[model samples]
Target: MTYIDQLGASAKQSAKVIATLSTATKNKILVAVAEELLKSEEEILTANAKDLELACSKGKKPAYVDRLALTSERIIAMAEGVREIATASDPIGIIDTGWLHPKGMEIIQKRVPLGVIGMIFESRPNVTIDAAALAIKAGNAIILRGGSDAIYSNTMLKNIFVRAGIAAGMPPASVQLVEQTERAHVRELISLNNYIDVIIPRGGKGLKSFIIEHATVPVIETGAGNCHLYVEKSADLEKAYAIILNAKTQRPATCNTIETLLLDYELLVAFLPIIAQKLADAGVVLAVDLTCMEILNKHKIIAEHATSADYKTEYQALKITIVAVGGVEDAINHINTYGSGHSEAILTEKMAASDLFAQEVDASSVYINASTRFTDGAEFGFGGEIGISTQKLHARGPMGLRALTTYKYIIRGNGQIR
Candidate 1:
């Protein structure tokens, strides 16, 4: 058998033990892991240094190298994130519903573990702590397959976390890491349906699509937020300026970063120039539709001509596409058809329009007056997330500890016949 197959078998066996573990024990393990991460900061940093050196030699961008470089401060933050996850409410055994049958049986549906989870993520060693924390807290074993870019960092962090769990009286196998960063290894892991109960793909569209198309395992596809920021007719112009700037430039590498700006036609004469000019001034490439283009040129606000493909692009860069919609309904239609079905927001003071947009948009998290960046597990008060699930089945939005769980029916009867 292959190495992945062997790892899968071990994880499957360990998952049986994890599923039956109590919340207290899980939290104990989490707390210990956090403490260990703090104690082992030097070791972790040393490992991260290797990754940084290698990344620099390979000519990786500064931003990319920064992601791989874990400083002392960042290590503490990661530990605290894990500790915060430990303190979140336990998701297991929550009674979804309980009812009595006329035939004299007590039927209760309770949350249960989801068994082993396979998580594929890109460079971000902090995800190592977050994934392991959430998986253990939710009573599920997880196998991490992180990007080769942060190989040394991930390897060291995973060792610390798993060792800490083991020292804290949890099975060490419960938290597994695929040390190999080969693309073939990722494909193999995603394809292991029998052992991995669910797969959480946590990167760009390319990674999510790869798992979606090839994985026989159930997947929670995350992060293809080709998100939007719509400026309504009654929107406060200052609010519009601040919101759009924060959404696009706050962090462009993130999935929730706004890729499109939809303006209500009624506001075109009044607010388009103000919003467009600010974005352009900030070095944001504005891809404008023909209607908006005419207005921009008339006002001498330069912009790039938006093509059909522009609307569909997830520009994880300093860029945004501008489109003019007739009204709220047109805005909703444009979002529903072209959105990646992640997060979409409407900047409207009109309660009715906001309500309608929130109700009609079919994303995991629909925003009324908030930025799409708020579409995160930690922001939703779940501590930290595995990632944002754009898929509709198992979980949606930022997948917290609870999203990693499944439900089971528990029935009780006193020698009753069926």
Candidate 2:
């Protein structure tokens, strides 16, 4: 058999063994893996250094490098995240609902593993542990295909997991990483319909699009964040400023960061200048529509003219698009048109406006009087997420242990027939 075919068969076989493991066994394995990760910090850093050196040699952008690089603190946090997952309640084998049938039968729905998961993500080495820990907790085996830029880090982390997990009595091949970094491997991995139950792709539009077009197996779509932050006319200026600053500048490379700023026309003249200066102070470049540009010009603030494409872009950098809208309705319309359906937030004091925005915005996560950055799995108390799903089919929002599970029907009958 070919390389990917062998990986697929191994994962498929491992899934059955993992699915039968008790919750305590899974938790024990996860905790062991976490401890091993902490103990192997130096080795992990050495591997990450190699990847970083290659990324730097290729002249990768700072944001890209930041995502690929790993520090001691980050490794600590990664370990802690795994421990948290161990602490989370296991979802497997829990009865969701039950009913007695009129025909003398008992029907019950129980949560079960999705069998095997195929993860295709970008250059974030921490995801290696998060995905494996979550999949094991949810009683599923996983096959990981991380980006080429993070191959060294990913391989090292996966090796640690496999070693620790097996030592802790977990089944072999419970977590497997694709060593091949070639583009064709992605297609082959996703196309393993008989082996992989579901494919989760976490990356840019290009990667997601390729999987959607090529994969024969099921997929859960994680989206790009062309997220927006709208300031209603009745918003508290200080609160709005703080929320926007945190959402845009705190970690602009994240998928949940705001890419667009929408201002109520009535509040535009008053609030725009303050936020513009604050973002500028943080080295954020602004691309503004005509109305916003005119106001910024009066205040001697410089900005680039925003193109139609700018509104639809996920900057993933220290840049934002600014626009003036008539009111909540107009803001919602613009967001629905340009937003990526990931995360959207509104800073407003009026309960009515907040309610309207929360109810009307088409996104996986909507926030009021808060930063969009809080749309994280850990922040939502899921330990760590496999991905933040934007599609509405199987899962949505920050996918935790439960999101990785599906349900099966169990029926009991005492010789009762139709």
Candidate 3:
């Protein structure tokens, strides 16, 4: 059998053993893994440095390098995140609903593992630890296939998880990383429907589209974010400025960061100059619609003219598109037309405006008077997330432990016949 085939078979076999583990046993293993991550800080950083060097050699963008780099503080945060997952209530085997049938039969629904999850992600090596920790805690096995850009960092992190888990008496192969970075391996991995129960692709639009189109295995889509922030006329300018600045500049490399800004036309002359200068001061490149461009020009600010493509793009950098809309309805229409259905927010003090925007915007997470960056699993108190699923089927927003689980029915009968 080929390498990916072997990985699938081993992961499937390991899934059986992991699925039967008690909550206490799983928690023990997770805590041990977290401790190991902290203990192996030097090794992890060393591996990350290698990947960073290669990335720089290729002349990768600063945002791309930032995603691939790791530091002592980030290592600590990863370990702490794992420990938090261990402390969460296990979703496996929890009864969802129980009832008695008309024929004196007892019926119940209980949560269970998805079994042998396949994660194909890019850049961030920390996904290695977060995905494995959540899968293990939910009593599922995971097979990780990270991008080539982070191969060294991911491999090192996987080794740490394997060592800690085995020493803690967890089943071997419970967490497997595909070291092969060949693009063909992705197609082969996704085709193993018999072994991989489901595939979760975390990357750009191209990666997500490729997996959805090619993978025969079931998928829980985590969308590419083209998030937006809308500022209504009634918004508090002070709060709006803070929210926009933080959302766009705090961490532009993340999926939740705002890529487009929709402003109420009534507030264009008043609020646009203040916010535009703030963004420009932070080295943000502005792509503006005609109305916004005119206003910025009058204020002596330089901005590029926004095109139809700019509104649809997920820049994932220090850039934002600004558009002036007639009102909330116009803003909602623009967002739904161009958004990836990820995260969206509105800055408004009027109850009616915020309510309308929240109810009408087509996104997983909608915010009012808050930064779009708050759309994170840990911030929502799930410790950490596998990914923020933008799909409507199995999951919607920030996916925590429960998102990794499925449910089964149990029926007990005493010779009841039709």
- What is the alpha-carbon lDDT of model 2 when measured against the actual structure? 0.94
lDDT of 2 by residue, 262-361 (tens): 9999987788998999999999999999999999999999899999999989999999999999999999999999998999999888999999899999
Of models 1 and 2, which has the larger lDDT? 2
The TM-score between candidate 2 and the true structure equals 0.99
lDDT of each: 0.88, 0.94, 0.94
Q: Which is superior by lDDT, 1 or 3?
A: 3
* Sort order, TM-score high to low: 2, 3, 1
The alpha-carbon lDDT assigned to residue 301 of candidate 2 equals 90
Tens-place lDDT per residue, model 3, 342-392, is 999999889999889989999999999889898888999987899999999
The Cα RMSD of model 1 versus the native structure comes to 1.7
Q: Using lDDT as the measure, what is the rank order of every candidate, best first? A: 3, 2, 1
Per-residue lDDT value at 112 in model 1: 93
